[model samples]
Target: MTQGASGRDGGNSLKARVKTAKSRTLASTLWLQRQLNDPYVARAKREGYRSRAAYKLIEIDERAHLLKPGQKIVDLGAAPGGWSQVAAAKIGADKPKGEAKGKVFAIDLLEMAPMPGVEFRQMDFLDPAAPQLLREWLGGPADVVLSDMAANATGHKKTDQLRIIGLVELAAEFACEILGPGGAFLAKVLQGGTDTALLARLKRDFAQVKHIKPPASRSGSSELYVLATGFRGRREATGEDGAG
Candidate 1:
């Protein structure tokens, strides 16, 4: 792939985009620096993935084999559709009729460019009506529910963590409501002795619960992924939004 100035291809993979010197603030400069030098960012563009976040899903899938031919998947907070793209491909979402026809249903607040094998809904996952709409579209339970959903960062540390935790909790509730028996759920989490309670709940719900820090995640980052598998079907009388 011929990488351009924006680093959209594999050619010159490690080269950084040169930026003009300006009177920008220190934080802005640092952010620009990080973006310019991020190899994963460049590689993601080259591979035509929506974002570098795609590789995190790839790493975990390599470990868990959650995406199978003809499997149905729900991509929570799949803005820009990177994870959705990966899941869609893994599940054989695109093919000639009756040829391993898998499905990927992705929901997010941000508009995303189209990707093959992905059916997208541009709406906030937090909307009260969102889950209903998703269910109507899915027509039944799904094989996997994956969440890369994150609350918009407010910069304050504790608040940001809490906000993301809330999103993760909501995703879990959605998973319990809709994931098929023996299904899987995955979420991005910040590591720091946080999310222990959430982890405990996940352990109770699934046969296996483990955490992974994928190589595609930035080294300076505190993010890790939680993988929960073998979902025990929810009992009757459980609410549509279960234990959010």
Candidate 2:
């Protein structure tokens, strides 16, 4: 990826434009142009982040105050690890041996390069064994679960929205299962916000539930995030288990 100076800086400047290429699809060309002009993309490169998405988590956490030292975190669909990177840094995951700090366990279908403070696992997070494995690695239930996953766009608005909602629902379910009491869940949703049913479920399980659009997120994009904090412990089919 190439970085270009953005008008977002104090200096006045024109947005960079990409010339149409015969070999490139129009969609790809437009995406390239957007990336070129995106201030966060350039900033991410300067700051050594995996992607521009890191700033979204940074902005959200700044207000929500979720990440903390010694907290355990799970990052769903964490390939390329932008959010994971932020979580590790915020939670002091890179502290030296014998110095207590948070742990970050990340999972994705695609392989991620190793990072000092993050443990990356390549597999479907929906696999039956995934929750157990992450808990084992963390040595306990997580303080937070984050999902920045998005389904491949089908170009149909309703269908795409539904797919995004479905992914968030699944992530929320996983978080409930793996999070300790007072845990938090953060995941990507669409512009319409979370589904009514999902929002009700989150409200029941968490003390606070709301949708947020961080400044790092594109203003015109449909992307929104649903945040649920202060988990009330997991509910059970028969009886709820006491979380440590």
Candidate 3:
């Protein structure tokens, strides 16, 4: 991939444009054009991140103050491993023999190339055994849970939004089960107005819940991230505290 001299720095060149080919659909051609013009994509290549999505997490953490050293983190749907790379570097997981050393467990249905300081697992997160296996691998509860998963888009707006919401809600439930007290959860969501129930649930279980759209996300995209911090720990129906 190559980038021209035009970007946020205000060079005088025009944005890179992709010409549609006989075999390429217009949508695919437009997407290729956008990727060619996106500064984050070029920056990710230069900075050694697996995907441009890494900057979204970086922007979120810059303000949220999550991903501290010595914390154990779980990355769901982590194939391509952009977020895992950031988490590993931030939490000192790549450091050898240090008090600040941390652990990162990343899982996805698709295979991922090996990354330094990351343990990758290829499996469905919804598998009944996954939560226990991930906890065992981490050697305890996780301090942070990150989910960048999204359902396959069917191109129907409402249906797509519902599918994404369902996936994030499941990720949230998984985080609630595995995060230790005062932990945090971040997951992708759509910007439709239908996530009130999810927000309410997060508000009840976490000290803070907010929606954010990072600068890395394209202006016209509906992508938003739900960040829940300060997990209050699990509770039973009787209002008794339960193990996380």
Candidate 4:
């Protein structure tokens, strides 16, 4: 992958302009302009990544050291398979005959193109049977759970934040159910970070929890990632211990 292509250095790169077209909406025109000039997009094309979003996971994993060979990973909302690609490479999931055999199970509502190491299920992760199916595919509890899921933008800030939070919460709950002891969870959230209630619940379950915004993310974007590491263990569904 090409270096020195951080989104923060956009001013240093030559800008690309999109010609106005009768068919293109204002939103699409602006999106095209941004994509055309985004160095990460260009680097993704050159490096054969599914999308520039792959770099976000790469940056986070570099710091957190979450993806290890021989580990089991669950990728939520893995459509387009950018994060899955990075996870597969880092965990050596694609290795055909290596002692360090890793596993990656991906779930998304939309269809994803197949990759060598990834096992994909096209279904709503909220479905009651999804967790069982994922465990069946993984053959064991997950070491890392990743969620880059995001709701469609309604152009309303508060409403959008709520939707984003709702997705993150569901993903977090699923992670709690499937992750083994000392596992890790990472999910995309908003600029203000996770809500208080959700953060408190995460703090109760994880030894270390924090928010991170990788340089690959556009500086102007409100997107951030919440990372929770050192999961104590799976909580009993019935609250057997009554430890809130």
What TM-score number comes out for model 2?
0.92
Q: Candidate 3 has which clashing residue pairs, if any?
A: none
Candidate 4 C-alpha lDDT tens digits along 1-244: 4453754344555677899899998888999999988888878887889999999999998888889988999999998999999999899988775544799999998999999799998998899887777877888789999999899988899999999999899998899888888899999999874799989878888888999899899989999999999887766752633133
Q: Which sections of candidate 3 miss by over 4 Å?
A: 1-12, 97-100, 237-244
**Candidate 4, which ten residues in sequence have the lowest lDDT sum?**
235-244
- Which model is ahead, 2 or 3, in terms of lDDT? 2
User: What tens-digit string does per-residue lDDT give for candidate 2 at 1-244?
Assistant: 2233244553655788999999998889999999888888878888899999998999999899989998999999998999999999899997677774899999999999998789888988888888888889999999999999999988898999999999999999899889988999999999874679999889888889988899888988999999999898877732454322
TM-score of the candidate numbered 4?
Answer: 0.92
Model 1 segments more than 4 A misplaced = 1-25, 97-100, 237-244
lDDT of candidate 1 over 19-132, digit per residue (tens): 656787666777888876776676777778778888889988887787898888899888888899899888888665567477899887778777778888887776777766
In model 3, the worst 10-residue window by lDDT is 1-10
**Which portions of model 2 show Cα errors greater than 4 Å?**
1-12, 237-244
Residue 59 shift from truth in candidate 2, angstroms: 0.5
- Which stretches in model 4 have alpha-carbon errors above 4 Å? 1-12, 97-100, 237-244
Candidate 3 TM-score over all chains jointly: 0.91
Please report how far candidate 4 places residue 39 from its true position, in Å. Answer: 0.3
Scored against the true structure, residue 170 in model 3 reaches a CA lDDT of 93
lDDT per model, in order? 0.79, 0.88, 0.87, 0.87
